[model samples]
Target: MRFGMGQQRITRAECAHVAALARLELTDEELDRFTGQLDELLDHVAEVEALDLEALPPTMHALPIANLLRPDTPGEVLDRDEVLAQAPFAEDGQFRVPPVLGEAP
Candidate 1:
């Protein structure tokens, strides 16, 4: 089996186990894909382990971030009729979208 150093080739059995734990139902193809994806992810983690950070003092953070400014003032808005005119199907001053929630029969 082709393998990356320190990376365990995730097996179908492990995929199935994980799918069960996650309450996911996967077909054989999906299981195989998940195994490969997990193996690649572990390989990346193994590479990260090789990083050298011994010289630098443990800095808890890189930079502090402040809240971005946003304006609360009302700005010019699109006219409802103008906006609704662009839709292929609009109902009563609103854009019509495909029903996701069940509609009354």
Candidate 2:
């Protein structure tokens, strides 16, 4: 099977081969469904390739973008003792979090 001029259609055998390579065990119904879906995707790609895109400028994004973050500048640091006082569990001037690796605190 072929799509658009010379774009070879994705075959069930090829799809099965790819699935085997990826260690997948696909059923006949899945192969058929995926082959049809991949063929449709390839057809769309071929259609895009057939377009004359030389006149259009390439873009990384479809719409214009700008950084919305505030400018990074030195800010007042929170007092360590004050912040630690608010924690439910604070020890040795730092927040005390539960052990993660099953190690004793």
Candidate 3:
């Protein structure tokens, strides 16, 4: 399944060759199915490459947008005693979460 800028050759024989290399024994029906899927995928890629995207600037988002956010500011926090009192489990000055590894308690 070699794909690059040049061209895409996703024939049944090619798919079969790749499958054999991977020690996979695919049935003829599966090979044909994968070959057609690969060809369709390559055709889509070719279509995308044929588009005139050069006129447009590269952008992470498709639309013009900005993060509408408030400025970070210092604020009052929950009291330690009050917060700890609501915890299902707590030890000393921290919440007692279950063990991350080993057998479950």
Top TM-score model: 2
Candidate 2 least-lDDT 10 residues = 1-10
Query: Model 3: residues >4 Å from true position, as ranges?
Result: 1-9, 20-24, 68-70, 87-105
By lDDT, highest first, what's the ranking?
2, 3, 1
Better of 1 and 3 by TM-score: 3
The residue-level lDDT of candidate 3 at 80 comes to: 100
Candidate 1: list runs displaced more than 4 Å: 1-8, 59-105
Model 2 Cα lDDT, one tens digit per residue, 1-105: 335654557778999998999999999999999888887888888788789999999999999999989999999999999999999889988899879987655
- Candidate with maximal lDDT: 2
lDDT string, candidate 1, 3-32, tens digits: 667647677798799999999999999998
Model 2 segments more than 4 A misplaced: 5-8, 73-81, 88-105
The TM-score of predicted model 2 comes to: 0.67
How well is each residue in 1-103 modelled by candidate 3, as lDDT tens digits? Answer: 4466545557688889888999989898999988888778887877787799888988988887877797799899989988999998788989988798853
Cα distance off (Å), candidate 3, residue 27: 1.9
RMSD for all candidates, in order, please. 8.9, 3.9, 5.7
How many residue pairs clash in each candidate at the backbone level? 0, 0, 0
Better of 1 and 2 by TM-score: 2
TM-score-wise, the better of 2 and 3 is 2
